[model samples]
Target: MLAKRIIPCLDVKDGRVVKGKQFIHLRDAGDPVELAMFYNEEGADELVFLDISASSEGRNTMVNVVRSVASQLNIPFTVGGGIHSLENIKALLRAGADKVSLNSSAVKTPELITAGSDFFGRQCIVCAIDAKFDKDSGFYRVYIHGGQKRTEWDAIEWAKKAVSLGAGEILLTSMDRDGEKNGFELNLTRKISESVDVPVIASGGAGKLSDFSDVFIRGEADAALAASVFHYKETSVKQVKAYLKQEGVAIR
Candidate 1:
């Protein structure tokens, strides 16, 4: 069995790391480069840097920030937000990102996924889906443009479509649970994980250490990504890994 990965996320805005509750009322956390280096040394399995406002602001990702954070990390780094074209993905790859996450652009122009995978290989492309429960549809609906807009696509259907279009992995985030310390959306995570063949990274709603184990085991997530808990120092990567190992969860 592959070891479950514990990833630390850097939700950056204006070059600084930030966190918020349910993707609102944003607040500063720290510097992106500093946090990257800290997590690299702190035994994090991987690092994810998201330019949280780039798409909504109608701009490209902050390549400068990507370069700065990339310089400090030896582990795999994934960068996303405001990436619209192949050139944008190329620029980020040259700037040092191992993988480029496609969200808004993927929803707007899905062929980009097949194009990126064809040119750069599927492993270099990740499909990030931000979703929340829809009362009218009675299903999770995909959100885009930094969770500011909703699409008609159902979350489960989109995950399968993204994988079929050549996405190497799925980065699934629960907008309803984002930045909340309660727990991850197990039902959503499990549905996506079971629906996609690619590895699924369960994101959002991670509070206590037990939440990690719960998602990995019950949700069947291949990886778990968290920001607030690690950013606030409520728990460290090493501490979480240790706790997971003790809980009989295979972790790296």
Candidate 2:
């Protein structure tokens, strides 16, 4: 069995790390550089940096910030937000990102995923899906442009398509549970994980140690990513990992 991964996310905006309920009403978490280095020292298996506002603002990812945080980490890090082209992918990788994640841009122009994978290899490209429950459709709907724009595409179908197009992994985030701290959306995660052969990183709604275990054990996610809980010192990666280890879940 592969050891499950514990990843800490840095949702950077205006050069500061922030968190909020359902990705709204943002509040400061800390400095991105400081948080990145701390997670590296804390034995975190990986780090994720998202320039949360880039897509909505209609701009490229903040390369300067990416470079600054990348310099502090030895572990693999994935960078995302406002990434729309091959040049953007190259710039981010050059800025020190081991991988680049695409969301709104990919939704708008899915060929970007194919282009990115063909050029950088699928291992270097991640397709991020932000989703929210739809009352009318009674299924999760994909949200793009930093969760500001809604798409008619069903979340599950999009996941499969991304993998078929060479996305190495899926970074699935449940917008309904983001920062709610209730736990991850295991139902949604499991659905996607089962639908896609590539690795899926579960994000949003991690409140306690058990939440991490539940997602890995039941949701079948390869990794669990969280923010506020770790950023505020409310929970530690080691504690989560130890709990998973105790629960008979393979974890490093």
Candidate 3:
């Protein structure tokens, strides 16, 4: 089995790293460059930097910020938010991002996913899905614009479609679980992971070490991403990996 990955997420708003609950009540985390360096030193398998407001603000991602953070990292990192075009993806790659994640843009024009994968390879394309459980509909609904807008797309269907369109990975974030620290949205993660052939990185609501193991073993996620717990020093990548190793989950 391939070793599972432990990733730290840095959600940036206005060029500063921040964290929030359910995508609200935002609080500053730290400098993006500093935090990236710390995670690199902590043995994180990879890092994710997302511009939380870029989509809603109608702008592109922070290239300078990406460059600064990427320069400090030894491990691979994924950058997302406000990435709409092939040029944008090229610019970010030029700025040092190993992968570019598309959310609203991919939904708006799925051809971008196909085009990007064709031009940059599917490995460079990551489809990010921000989903929330709808109690009435009994399904997970996809959200975009940094979780500010709702879409009719069902999360599972979207994941399969994206993968078919050449998205090599899925960065699945559960808005309902964001910052809840209860655990990951295992049902949602597992459903999507099982439905798609591409790797799925489970995001949101990582509170304890076991949450990582649960997502890997039960959810069958390729990777697990956390924000507040790692940002505030509640846990470390080493600690999570140690626990997962103890649980018999393969880890790098």
Please, what is the whole-model Cα lDDT of each candidate in the order they appear?
0.88, 0.86, 0.87
Per-residue lDDT, model 3, residue 199, is 96
Per-residue lDDT over 1-252 for candidate 1, one digit per residue giving the tens place of the 0 to 100 score: 689999988877766676533322223235677677767888999888888664544244378777877887789999988788999898888898899999999999999999999989999999999999998889999999889998999999999999999999999999999988889999999999998899999999999999999999999999999988987778889999999999999987
Worst 10 residues of 3 by lDDT: 20-29
Judged by lDDT relative to the true structure, which candidate is superior, 1 or 2?
1
TM-score of 1: 0.90
Q: Model 1, residue 209: displacement in angstroms? A: 0.7
Report RMSD for candidate 3.
4.0
Clashes of each: 0, 0, 0
lDDT of 3 at 51: 81
For all predictions, the C-alpha RMSD in Å is 4.0, 4.1, 4.0
Return the TM-score for each candidate structure. 0.90, 0.90, 0.90
- Candidate 1 stretches with Cα past 4 Å from truth are 19-30, 53-61
Residues 41-67 of candidate 3 have per-residue lDDT tens digits of 778999888886645442443788888
Predict model 1's lDDT versus the native. Answer: 0.88
Lowest-sum lDDT 10-residue window in model 1: 20-29
Candidate whose lDDT is highest: 1
Clashing pairs in 2: none
- Measured with C-alpha atoms, the lDDT of residue 6 in candidate 2 is 92
